[model samples]
Target: MCSGFPALFFAVAYNNPRDSWSQVVPIRLRLLRERFVVFFGKGSYGRDTLINTLGVLFAAVIPVAVLPILSRLYSPAEFGLFGVFAALVGLGTIASTGRYEAAILLPEEDDAAVSIACAAFLFLTAFVSALAIIFTLAYFIGVGSVRAHSALIGLGVIAVAFSGCVQILLSAAIRKRVFAKVSFARFCAALVSAFLSILLGASTQYAEGLAIGVTAGYAVCALILSRVVARQYGGVSLPDRAAIYGQVKRYRNFPLFSLPSDFSNTLATNLPVLFFSTFFGSAATGYLTMFQRIWAGTSIMVTGLGETFRQRAATERQQTGNFNRTMRVTLLPLVLLSVVLCATLVLLGPKLFEVVAGVEWREAGVYGQILAPFVCLQFVASPVSWSFYIAERLKLLAVWQLALLVSFSLSLFVGSKLFSAQGTLAVLSCVGVVLYAIYILISERISREENKVS
Candidate 1:
């Protein structure tokens, strides 16, 4: 019965609430009569709770469940070294041949998606090799140090990046409403990664175990993901490079200039650990990293909200060439979730941290309480920028880049000088709010113009 609500919703939603209740009764009867077989059979699996829980499961496992156990198994110094390596790996990844994989599902069909995904895998693989050669040389030549040996770290990064390609396909599968297959791939990865982490921890200490588990797990995950993708999509062809490039060029407005802003955002958000290691000890950085993860957990809300909005906005735009409803839906949740998340993180993060993270990170509780609110604000503010992506306003996105530059620079300098470790959180939060406010005004103005045009 509840499974039919989403499809039946339009009958009621398209009219005034007072009048729509009468229509809903008839619509409900009609839906059950005609669509009962579909709804009860497959649609039951696509219920809201099932969809949401799947998302939350991945969000929880990726950062918290897996990483925490790995963290405890390893030393802070080793972890910090790994963090630095991850920072570098993550940096180049954003531009891995221009995120060719993500170009899929943009109004583009599965074939376009396939090309982008395949091209992205090949591109990122080559990109990884180049980076490995460059970094490995630097490590040996006294230029830089990548912990856990460059070969292992390089392998893990490549595997993880490839897994990213698989995850994208899984996400595309979910978007296409294939819940059972998505569930299979997700749990398989989760179980394998979790077990691998424990086994690896039994022998290798610190970053080494974490790195191996990640690399080996990626190998398994990628294989499972490919099988599931093949089952769902059936058959593939060599991607049309020209056609793929055409698609990329068509959406050139999407992430091109905004790409740097995205990268900077990641850096500004996580670079604190680098600063932490430099200023404080490795242990101090580790204490704070757990809080960073908790804050990331709070961001799951933002991700969900954005996902819902993107779908709504796309539907609206196709039908009406504007996004008024999207703005309302997206912004309302952004504000409401921001408040709830910020308050909850501020209030409950301490107790929650202690229970979840154990005694080694008792200090992380205070860190979570202080940092979590800041992160909540940042996460809430973040999705507002997506409107620019949807509206083809990368120039406006670039404007925020300048704002981000100023904010990040000021935060880094001022926060480092004053609050030391604590100040980074405050500074980064402030910077995020400033940028979000700019995005809000710009988004509102664009919507107003769109309305005027209509």
Candidate 2:
């Protein structure tokens, strides 16, 4: 029954090959069973991992499905402004919760975890408020032109808060192994965002509609996730002032170090947009940004797996004092898959882009091809990089983050002077590959050291 094979399969014998189709059934059944064992085995890479990965994939697929329509409706220059806005908001979101949301799963007590979540949300509110004040002050003091798109930035502020809230809630759900709730909420959010973006693009003539739609999508997802948390985890109650302060003190390292680490990581990731806009043009930035969005499928997979891996690795390290197995299970398959995908994209990315998106985006496909190898390395290494956090190697993580920032900065400087936008992308992608390759080694070394101590 588990195999879903027909009952008649058991009645046939292997006496003759021509006797019946039963011989083929057993072979097919065996292959299916092997795959089941591989994906749903007795470890961190089991049913939960599969569910989370598939959920992330589903959520990502929705936006990708509608990208062609959105692309046609908007110009590359418009998308460039959206890219800059998104990059800034992304940078702000990294520090919104001061990385405290990441600590939600570490505490043993549910109430303590709830308190941590509260602290994160409160910190995010305060952070956004401070940013609003600073930006307002700067605007009034004869720097308004410098901060030109204040309205869109305000939307970004609200969206960052929502993003932080979603992170807190999702972290809690992951701790509780409530994969379905998180998945469903994400899927709904993506669907709503895609629909609104398409509708606004069709009905309006500006890029702000796309931005607002994106923010609304995050708002909707945050609300949906909050409801799920309330139903499943009894809602996060505000801890007593003492409990909240205590949790903050306990997790001070998260804000102190993880904050900067995550912040730098975000900046490093978005450096290309800034560089492209400055050195090339807004249209070039738009093309690069669009490619990144289309490539979000792979990034989401890495993130989904990383979240599940973080939870699993923490538990495994706590119980068995070993994390090496988690690394093996999480990285091996991803590496193999990345290799295959990179090869395919390198060969067909431009043609695929032209056929699927439009002739206008054919150049994006060429960029995608050039960037494929770097992305492949990133896909495999980024998730495993969580091992550093699980091992409580925050300082080491921060160092790597700095190294990444430097690498990207150097690549941009060198590439800009040497060649055109496409050439710069190629150079940057190569540098990305090198940095992530080093990251993989660092993560592996950390795991191995921890294993020895255990």
Candidate 3:
């Protein structure tokens, strides 16, 4: 009879849906805060999250502030080339680490953790070096064209190695709770890169300048963060080959399953640029790239939020063997935020883009509106998807990525056959939103299972 009171209350509340939600949400939030304290202790997750979010906010703001000036300095052709270069870097960076850097947080022993870091760094160096050789040979043999792609090929490999190095170091910092240092590094990188791109674009009048600026920023950021990581583990001995080999073997699932999953994910996102360049032209690719940049600026915020959540989630999983509370608290707010933002974009995106980016960019704004739903889902999903790794469910993640790749391919083929670039983006967005929804459900199920086990 007493238990029935709660059900009766909810039943009555639902008679007024809007009022019910408003009442229920605050109750949920209060419960969630209490649960967070139970899982993570007081002030830990909140403080670290604030620090991380501030860093991402600074990083995101700097580039966006300069975009107007950059758009004027660089032509669409240059931006298109810049997009291609970025795509390659994205694909290669994931491959470089072989996805083993994820294990840096799993080990309780500093020695074991350091070994995993070294293994990831070694793999990254070897992978990027091999890529450099391939590109250099291609250039020398006159296949990829030294004049057209040489600058990117030369810079791309370096960026991948440096970026991979930074990732390993940052992961170490995160594991150790050095949030402030990590955040500051992010801000500095964005600030330096934006100005460098502006100065270089104005002077050199080419896409290579943008590429160079980005790579240099990563290198500088990596250098600074490496110092923080080094000081944190100042006395720890470097991992020997045997230690690294064992670490690699121990975390083989990461490379075997996580690597393929990550590679597919990266390829799926970046393939549009290559395909568009082949089918539509550089101008179309340029427009798509501009939309992507705007989306990226927004994503950085979510990414920041996710990174902090991941650090906490990893700890929670290690201690509690489940992430049910974390999932419940995190997913609801983000989903709500995404829905609201996407709706707003769908309404005002075109005019906002035309006004801020210039009249020539109005079409890009229209594309932005078409793509908002997908971006919203991505913004929410990308960060939380790390839970799959935290939960050691890389096999499921791999399967999902394969399905995503297939869906994207079909969308591209159908869109190309049926309509134009606009139609293609529209089709992709619809398909993407559906897939992301499924992914969230799968992740939620995993969380529930963990809760049951706990």
Candidate 2 Cα errors over 4 Å, as ranges:
1-45, 141-148, 233-237, 299-333, 390-392, 445-454
lDDT per residue (tens digit) for residues 145-175 in model 3: 5647787778988889888988898899999
Q: Top model by TM-score, which number?
A: 3
Q: What does candidate 2 score in Cα RMSD to the true structure?
A: 5.9
Q: Tens-digit lDDT track for model 1 on 348-404?
A: 766766667666666667666666545655666566556676677766666666666
**Model 2, residue 357: displacement in angstroms?**
1.8
The clash count of every prediction, one per candidate, is 1, 0, 0
Candidate 2 on 143-223: residue-level lDDT in tens? 864477777777887888788888888888888887877889888888888888888899884677778888888888899
Which ten-residue region of model 3 has the weakest summed lDDT?
445-454
208, model 3: CA deviation in Å?
Answer: 0.9
Quote each prediction's TM-score: 0.76, 0.83, 0.84
Ranking by lDDT: 3, 2, 1
lDDT of 3: 0.83
Instruction: Give the lowest summed-lDDT range of ten residues in model 2.
Output: 2-11
